[model samples]
Target: MKLKMHISKIKCINDLTIELPIERGLYAITGQNGSGKSTIVASASRVFFNLPMKEYFGDTVDGAMIEFELDGNKRSWHKKGKSWLQKQTGSMNIRGFYEGSLIYGYRFKDTTYEKLKKSESIDKAKLRPSHEFIRKNLGLILQGDEDYYEKLYEVPREYAKFDSSIFFYEKNGIQVSQFHMSTGENLLLSILNSLYIKNKERKNASKQCIIFLDEIELALHPSSLKRLVAFLEDMARQYDYAIYFSTHSIELISGIKPDNIFYIERYNDGTIGVNNPCYPAYATKFLYDHSGYDNVLLVEDDLAKSIVTRILRKEKLLNSRLVHVLPCGGFRNIIKLADDVTRNNLLGKRASICIIVDKDVKEQAIKYKKENGLASSCGMNFLPIESLEKYLRMSLVYNVDQKLFKRLSDYVFQQRSLQELIAEYRKLKEFDTDKNGKVLYSLLDTELRNRRTDRAELIDLIVEYLFEENKQPIQDIKKFLHKELE
Candidate 1:
């Protein structure tokens, strides 16, 4: 059965207490090394591996617990000294790794997914990691659409090797070890073999699966890493599986959907785990300071960061030499992060933090500003409207990046000039008082970013277009920022 809601509470065993939405999708465990990423992995392993609580709590003094929802049932266990006190609210057919569908690990160096790297010769007694995987989930693998079968051709069995305790790739019909393959090729092969095993076993079992991995982006080229992330996300939906992986890759975190990232850290009290930290203050400051920026404006997401950065720089309200844009992920995250990063002179390079959210955030922001004295300290504001996207009020770009270039040209500016298009859209039923001041720009996100369109450049183009067209709302935005900065 798939895990629905899993919560792990711990103390002293790496000082962790975290709740994870360990459902069918990619969940990234991100932090510096030794920040308890592996501990979370171990907690998952303990639950699915049928290991004793004492195994991990061997010396854990403060007590720990694992509670999860599976197959519409709730189960939990807590460590009490060397024994586990188990409790359950419904019936469960508990199964371990051999149950056709269960949690698996690809932790590297010494992992259960592959034969030990130290094994010199193939021992028939122990199943070849891939083959053991093959025998367990062969049915499920074959059931996959053409992609399942396609994997074998891509990682042909003729080139598959286990004699040396590692999988190999076929090059010109020659079986070459993983070392011979390019890093990306090797990663792809490993993933293919693992998926193939699970697919093959899915044919006869009602078991759901979860895969735990760490530092999984190793050796992947940027393009290849992006592709792999897409593939894994898609597969999670197609099959019943959950992937929890750890990484120190900030670039990877930036590229991934913000919601998928969970930043682990050790608090001042020595407790660890980030249940749902939006901006992860420590890591944010760490990354920012390390990058050498002296002033920073923290916003909701990438889009807001881009918008705010462009306006602040254009108005010259922010010192060009020191300011940097940091997206706190969302409004909630911004609030959670504000408490820490807003402190003056934090982390040596911590910038003066300005917080922004939607119009809905005004009350909360104001309250927080007074309670924490952040208003005069740094700066805080909710936009003049509900949301930045809704505030901008561009219908075509409303869902920009949501669907790339789909019927875009057909929908926007068919025969009308820019001013005409704005007038037409403003007259539409959806254009209400809430959408005020946003009807100036054509709704389309820039069609095909020619060069680095992911930054303020895209926002710059839109603002420039409006200024040249004499759009009043564009001027209003500048005035608002000028006042906020003042």
Candidate 2:
């Protein structure tokens, strides 16, 4: 499935379009509160998000246009002066995909649950939101229709561990509804129902459909949100649906692949634009404008985050109340982090964001920067070696044998197994720094394992070596701290 959209003068956005082809996968629209992220989704889904066409008009503007190509067929809606026109028609039924009114045709800003709770009359207030939502989602499947719902068998492995889950039905002698479903669960059921309904939209046509879920993270517990994201991603891959979702949750952005994400923001010129998450300015803006942290160092993961935190502590610069290391999942997030930084710099929001990306992705990082012409405002830096592991490995104190260095190098650098290297280290009675970094993240886990060694203690050993031998990296970090803290 492919969708190319162009909208101009239809809100804060003025002449917005994306040149690259959008393929079937998840597309995230993210930015500050008023960045027109919702407007983009609203325009894509007109049936659910219908607003007065003229109300979206720009100052001194007489016309507004929103056009898009769905499955290579061009369809457009234009408002010229006092008139509106549909330039072309297509077989794709966005309206039909709304399925049935029983599914709750459009999403409501306020939920029925809230309304019922506030009502004074008890007789009219005792309805469950999950009743209609679950029945529509799972009801048809249990009856006979299985083709669509069957895809859910590939549910993420994480769901098996859900101590609490939403149950639609209980057969034989089982009591249910005693276990309450979360708002997140109800919302997930509603979305799945929508997809099942979409399948019914182009029945047996083998047609592609677009599903736009706005601010999908609502009412979601973090764990529930993660499960939902994984489910939706897997669902998109397994089916022909092209998913378009919007979220301000950094967790959601990090959960999905970098290529699948998009960023939207209000520009300096009183217009809003949509851009790739890799845009350097996007991350800058995100950290300064949208997020809660005051001073953040964006790193690759927990291990690197730990190292940075330790280094900051060594320097006595880690103000627990003000500064922290945020591992943005991976190297690709550098761009997203950069985007946040750039926007913050522009808005004068007074945020300090330092990004430390892995060395492996430096080439891809530079290429993206040049391609998008992202201003160098993110204070971006690349690791000297492959990963945080490599740095720690090299920084480890080599004892017992310089003779074992060759043997260690062979096992460590060969991309061999971590368990193999650990075994070699134990047998040789030598301590080699870990460059592969597998141990870095495990060291940061708060819960202690009974059998597991105190890896945090060993980290101090490596860090001591780093402080004594590797002075340059610390100096660089100090610079970042000074800038952010000041």
Candidate 3:
């Protein structure tokens, strides 16, 4: 059911690889604007038809290659100049079924309905299936509204310039043409009509159907969007269909399984990256939803969060779906938050919360806990080292290989010899936390801002060194938080 795709040298997407479910499931590819979500959909759509490369990538594209696997065979589509070449399967069945499966709501603009209105020919028979589909599905979305079911009539159509002139019935059975419908209603009708029409036209030519709907949430009311999502879920299951939605709807993305959601981002290096099984909080930039997680590990900063996450992953104790490592302000705030959660049972008995701070803050955390009469079950823990920066510095001196050390020095210190830089860094007053003096963590953060080099990547190298040089400290933290696994 897993379909792996790799697209390289194409438009804004330099190189991107993603995995999608090809069998039967609803999947979403979402991200901020210009992250290549639509481009990915276009690439996948090209597999089914001979689309012009110029349509998507404009006039200039250094040769592009898109590869995917179908039935244990690797198939590729290559684009050079203005034309596309395909790895021929010799049979037209798969392509034939998929060619009619793409639906773009934007394809139906106000002008389109205007054209439909002037057409003279009427085709009541061809409109029956899609009209019935919209009536039944729309009724579900408008469940409490009597008007939707009692007054709305089956869409009637007259064959038009493009395809058909669609009409809707309102209260008193009054006829309203497609041009008169609200944008949300028009969008919904266009989507369902296209889907039903395509499926009907295919007529079970293939056992599985793949649909790519771009910007599916365009102009839909939030309530209608939710119901449409549920309706599509049912449709996906009823018929063996793999439906792909390229959208920006948080409501739509949040409801999907983490593995089925793909988050796309264009990094500073101008290459597209796709994070499959992306967390909903990450995709929407709304971190408050911890409803599905069983445990939350509160840390002082993102670096600490990365360190804890890396350790848990290294020990095989991390399941991202269940555990959330959240960076919650400073040391004082994290301690206070943990104490409050424990004393008030904020997360209830079913969820576990743990506080982890740097080793340097252990004394202060202990003092605060005693002053507030914090419970022992508050689960206070500390990193093995004084701070992540100090630990990373130590690792650079002793643990890392020449290649990695050089890379780290080049990125963080701006090509300054790390030994000299570390000596100077140690001499500064309040070097660990001073903002004016350019704290080591702040320097690393600047690298992130300037180059999009994530702190997580730096943490990966540091944790890799920790796993080899010292792993017991990580094991101890994992042991203290074992209630999460329960």
Find the candidate with the highest lDDT and give its number: 3
Candidate 1: deviation at residue 244, Å?
1.9
Candidate 1 regions with alpha-carbon error over 4 angstroms: 1-19, 31-35, 51-57, 61-63, 85-192, 203-207, 217-227, 264-266, 270-285, 288-296, 302-326, 330-353, 370-377, 387-476, 480-486
lDDT for position 202 in model 2: 49
Model 1 CA lDDT for position 282: 31
Give per-residue lDDT, candidate 2, residue 396.
33
Best by TM-score: 1
Q: Is candidate 2 or candidate 3 better by TM-score?
A: 3
Task: For residues 273-367, write the lDDT of model 3, one tens digit per residue.
Answer: 77665655456543346645678788766567767877677667765447888765456656656666667666667777778888877898889
- How many residue pairs clash in all the candidates, one count each? 15, 21, 0
Please give the RMSD of candidate 1 to the true structure.
10.6
lDDT of 1 by residue, 26-108 (tens): 76777766577666665666555664555443555435676766667777777676667778888543332211111223313
Per-model C-alpha RMSD: 10.6, 14.0, 16.8
- Please give each candidate's TM-score: 0.56, 0.48, 0.55
- In order, candidate lDDTs are 0.52, 0.53, 0.65
The candidate 2 region of ten consecutive residues with least summed lDDT is 148-157
* lDDT (10s digit) by residue, model 2, range 100-134: 11223243223355443333222212322333333
